[model samples]
Target: MTLLLPPTSEVPVPKFNMADLTARLLAPGKPQEAQQQSSPALNPPDAPEAHEEVRERRRAYQRPAGHPSRQERAQARALAQQYRDYAEAWYQALRAWDMREVKIPYSFHYEPGESDLDFLTLGSNVRTPTRYLQTPAGEFTEGEVGVVITTMSRAPLVEQMQLGKMLDKLRHTPDTTPVSLLREDGRWHQNRERVARYAVAVLTLAVQLRDEGAEGPLRYAKAVLAGAH
Candidate 1:
């Protein structure tokens, strides 16, 4: 049997660095420029020398070395959950849905001598080679192909809120987004792709189990993904 995923014991907790974010947030706020100007003894905030000194001071900021803070950990958890939801939505309406066989809702028959009305009378069956394709078991029966899932349909309300916020931000500025902004806003960066793939694997298993297509294939996928046989 082909394995779908590595064993759970083999899967370690995924790590991503949010240290830059923690540093910025925990850093001191901007100086009160308007108030600072009132003091004649203080150097002009915009002066190159003062700017250089401030920049050097800011660069010295360092976060404690160890596990992330409670806030940072929560941020990571929320980010992961959001990514999983996005992955689920992505696969639901993918090409597999397009390949499902179409079923006519109403039946119709040709009148009296309709032999001449057949869609095609002189057509020959085509024998195309399918050597490279893997055949899936069972024939497709038309049923729920075009389902319009409404609000809060695929996931919980909170998850929908998360997904909504995420998509909105993506619509505005997808490019030129930096890593720190991603961590602060809980958006996914190019980090830890295995978790997204793991989400896909789990969703595929769920689909197979739901359709009950074939127990043999489902068991193999489940065993590999869930570390159970």
Candidate 2:
């Protein structure tokens, strides 16, 4: 019998260039004004030049070579934690036992916004095809706010229609929507096995979240948990 192997280890992530944000916020024009203020004695002299020097200095301070300050580090930690939470939540939904027989070869990520749904592919067992879902100047499904799951491959017409209907119901209903994905042919079907698996995955995630909340993170941990809830 052949033994199954674990998934390959993900690559190392690069540190975020926090300086990019700081630079944008501290752009040149404003710095020049501040620099002119520094030397009131110089007659309407080169305020722009002064601003340039000030901006340069500000840039240097914003991104020092040494380790980040405590506050900076804390912000980084918070962002890191959010990434972790998102991953955990998705994984919980994906690994439900009910969906075991169904192929879930593709991995997907979504960010819900006021007007559009942004999709990100997280490298699935299926072919890598990334796409974005947009209203596209009012073709259809515009102004109607809810989640829409699109597959790289087409699903059965009936199952596709059912998915749309169920999604509408869930949107109107107070509870979070439950959707199931079949790996083979990348279909979105409402089969009992698929639904059960999806439900179990989400429920497990919610339970895990509650458990994490219960375990205190000291003062900082408490603050993080509070923010999450």
lDDT of 2 by residue, 1-229 (tens): 9985433222112233555434534666676654433333332224568545545444544464465767889987776454334333343333321121223356665655634433354354475433321221111221222223322012367545454454344334425544323323333233534343333333222333343431322233224334443
TM-score of each: 0.21, 0.21
Pairs that collide in candidate 2 are: 32-51, 103-183
Badly placed stretches (over 4 Å) of model 2 are: 1-70, 97-150, 153-229
The sequence of per-residue lDDT tens digits that candidate 1 reaches over residues 64-90 is 435476788998677554544443333
Scanning candidate 1 in windows of ten residues, the lowest lDDT window is 143-152
TM-score of 1: 0.21
**Global lDDT of each candidate:** 0.37, 0.38
Candidate number of the best lDDT: 2
Cα distance off (Å), candidate 2, residue 195: 24
